[model samples]
Target: MTAHFVQVANAERLAADVMADVMTPPPPVDYLRWAEDNIIFTERESPLPGPYNRDLFFYFDEILRALSPDDPCRIVSVHKSAQLGGTVLANIFCGGSLAMDPGDFLYVHPTENNAQRWSKMKLVPMLKGTPALTKLFPMKARDGSDSVLYKERIDGKGAIQISGANSPASLSQVTMKRQVQDDLSKWEMNNAGDPETQADSRSQAHEFAKILKVSTPLVDPGCRITKSFEDGSQEKLYLPCPQCGHMQTLEWENFLANLDEDKPENSHFVCVDTECGGVIEEHHRPAMFKAAKLLELNGVEVWRSENPKAKRFHRSFHLWSAYSLLQSFERIARAWLNARGDPASEQTFFNDVVGRAYKTLGEAPPWEGLRDRAAKSDHPKGRIPVGFPIVTVGVDCQADRVEFQVVAWGRDYRRAVVDYGVFPGHISTKECWAFLDGLVRQEYANGYGRKIGMDLLAIDGNAWTEDVWGWAKRHLSSKVIMVRGVPSESAPLLARVKKERSRSGKLLSYSKRFYNFATSVLKMGLYRNLVKDDPLSRGHIALPRGLDDEYFRQLTAESRRAKRLKTGFIAYEWVKDPAQANEGLDTHLQAEAAAIKFGVRSMPDSMWDRYEADRERPPAEAQYEIEDLMAPGLPYVPPAPAAAPALPTKKLTKAKVRRGKWMNADG
Candidate 1:
């Protein structure tokens, strides 16, 4: 009876101890402390294979502190250069969170293949090396809990989910408490929507959720990481000059100011402080970083721009290669020197080394400049310029009117705008169709006394597909074809013709063909050509006189811009304001497509010579009459009068004719 009483008392004591442990709160998770105490680097992952040392990259301390569970900052963004320990910081956060604050964690990459590669090459090595993480997530053979995409704790407290931003399925099915997005700027959209936003929504149920975003920026205005950095407290790391003791952010300009190309090793950073005017050498970086830490403790190393939208809970940091321990000033200077002449290489240097977005060449030229230049044009509207052999027309069908642009193509891809106008009537009406029919059949006289007929005509069928297709069927012999604009940036300038199918999924007997051209690609090429000032250069465009300012405004209305579609996909396309009209631009794209269809892009000099020879010959007897081309029940509308008098029909030598300029009367 005494033994049984002792057993009962012991059992009661055990139950009380269990209750006390359950009621006690777990200690706050200090991310930096946990990382330093637990994480171990492997030879495969790091150059220094040992216990994690914060002193090596002391600049990461503030960012690491922001990721702690006790910190109020829920979103921590880092815009950094390539080898600045950004990836290491992410891994540390993942390892620390899994070990100390057991909760569902997520790690996202740009693509599924990237995620798999990172899991095998990066995550596995860290897990195997770190003893504390191994205990939580043991990788046993045939273990159901441990897999390539997921790793769950043995205690059932939490798990780590690996996913790709391009795969919507993996990101949608699970809820995560802490998430890390690597290379956020490279994340592409999936069918489910923007992967970043979708991943963020998974953690909305947790009030104290933590999100860490890290990336090297891409193009300006379109870079996702840049946008996030701007939305947060734009904190820039400032290191003090050893000589002046004045703090300044490490800027590329300051580094370049004193760089010697022949001897890059002699390069030094110039202190921007007006009073000090000190020159700092590379050896002073270590001491400067240490000084910056002391200044940080005194609330001075990091500074934020005045942004009202920035919240205390969101902290962001920006760093470049100059701050990286692995990168030297000489190496960065050499990279800049190598990338001096090439735009592509320069862009890479800016994005990967400088940690800044590169401004692309797709920006629109100043409309005022183009307008002022057009006023000095020697050719007049309604007449083909001298030496141009091929003429094509582009039509834009709208609800109220149909806009058209006539372009003449010459050798070396030089082009001139002959005429542009609008037929003010509903596109579906026969009257509007009649006007277009007459224009297509009309002939324009050139300065060489040659009447040039259009080789091909392209009509935009994106709005009224059926009507445009019907009209195209009637003019099949005249090379009048229907076209649609493709939204993709990588699509070809002009795609192969696609046969139209009926709603019942049957191919039509007529074998009607339509073309789809990449609008983004064509517009990019057009903008690049528009900025060329030399008249003799290839792709130079000549604008005829009498073109109004409104025409130029319409031509320059749309600029390449980054926009988020309804599906949450961010794309760079030609976008214009609601108040601006871009019909002229659309017709110009269509005209270029029509020129491509006429084989002008690949046309040899012999073919151009034949066209030039044909212009000197008499008119063909098989030309279609204006009455035969007019729409039924519509009155005949005469073509506009010539802008200039016809030149004498004197035969001239090919050498005497200016390829893309006004000809002298002596010719």
Candidate 2:
């Protein structure tokens, strides 16, 4: 009986020891130290798998420290490029927070699919690889505390919830102490409003709550991350020159001077300091990064704010691929070289490599400036300019009236607006149609004293499709055609002609074909051309002296805007105020489309010379027939047969046959 009592006493002592150990609080440690000692990188997630190394990403040290619970900063914003370890730093902070300072953590992505992808490819691997995180989330089938999107600590101190910015429900219904917003710039607004604000509201209940926002910027005016970064203490990494000790940010312009196109690997950075223009090689990047300091625009260290008593809650940092060890100078140089002359590719380089927003070229020029420039132009209205070989017309049909713009095309896509006017009658009436037909049939004199007929006339069929189509069918002998505008930005200037089909899916022989043109693409092109100051430059638009201020306002009525769609993707569209009229802009776009369809964009110099020679021909001599000037690549249209004598019965050589056809090419 005494032995059994001793056994029970020993068992009770052992149980007390286990209970005491479980109840004891963990030792105090900052987020940086905790992350370095506890975090592990799996092979699938990291290039340098195994243990987390602070030295490899020394630039992230200050950022990581700012995320600590002890730090006064409640918000950390990282405006960074891809492959710069920004996302990895975010992951480290989250892991450290869950293991060291237990709290209800929330992770938000741009979309549900993005959340699922990051959870499966990133979160699970990270948690399973780290011993500290695995202890909290065993990830077993029977473990009620673990899941693909949620994980709970064994001690029941806190849990993590993963969600997407697109789902309003996921961003609400729970209060979180820590939140991470990945790709915040790409987040879209839900039915409830801005996803960023919705997700941030969840953390309002906790006084010491923490939020980390990270993303590469998009366009400047609409980027959410850029706004956040500007609101906080804007800090940029400034590396000291090895020779002069002058601190400077690594700018792309300075690097371009030393970039060897033949051998990009030999590229180096030149110090921007005027007195100390030292050449810094790529090998010196490591030491420079280690000794780098974060400085504001005024050259003051960010950490050493002037007012220490002021409670600054947000800390923002900017990083680019040039500062990252994973990216080489050679790769950046190659990408820049390849992206030249292409706006889309260059935007990607700016966002993903330079970590800056791309200033889009789609912006409209000031209407006042355009009006002033037009007033000073030498060209006159209602007459074609010298050296112009083609004339095209664009018509905008409205319920009350119809607007038309006549444009002359010269070599290299140069344009001169010859005339523009409006007919007051309704488009559905025959009077308006008669006025447009008269304009199309009228011949205008050029500087060389030769009259030229309109090469192509494109009329918008969107408002009165049936009326426009009926008019177009009647003017089939002329160059009149029907066109409609499409919303796609990537569409070509002129899409393929779509033919009408019968109910049996058979092609209708007598059906009229209409073309779809990309309105955004043409409008962007026109706006860019309107700002060109040099008349000799290709794509330069020359305005006649008679254009009024109202014309200029109508021309610049619309402006390009960045809009987020329901799918969380950004789309650029031309938007105008409801009170504004955009008939001038619409007509110009249609005229440009008509010119493109006439093959003016792809005309060769030899063909243009032939047209010029024909214009300079004497009036007595038979001028080259207008019908024979069919645009290259267009279906051959047989011209009217000219009155000619019968050919000789004898066999003709190639030269004689050609001469004979010159008299009647259509025969």
lDDT of all predictions, in order shown? 0.78, 0.75
Clashing pairs in 1: none
lDDT of 2 by residue, 115-212 (tens): 98988888887788778888888777466677767888878898889899989999889999998999887786678777888888899998988899
lDDT of 2 at 186: 76
lDDT of 1 by residue, 350-405 (tens): 88899987666667788888888888888887788767879998899866667788
Inter-residue clash pairs, candidate 2? none
Point out where model 1 deviates above 4 Å.
Answer: 1-15, 47-50, 141-143, 297-311, 364-559, 562-571, 574-667
Q: Measured by TM-score, how close is model 1 to the native structure?
A: 0.60
For model 1, state the Cα shift of residue 132 in Å. 1.1
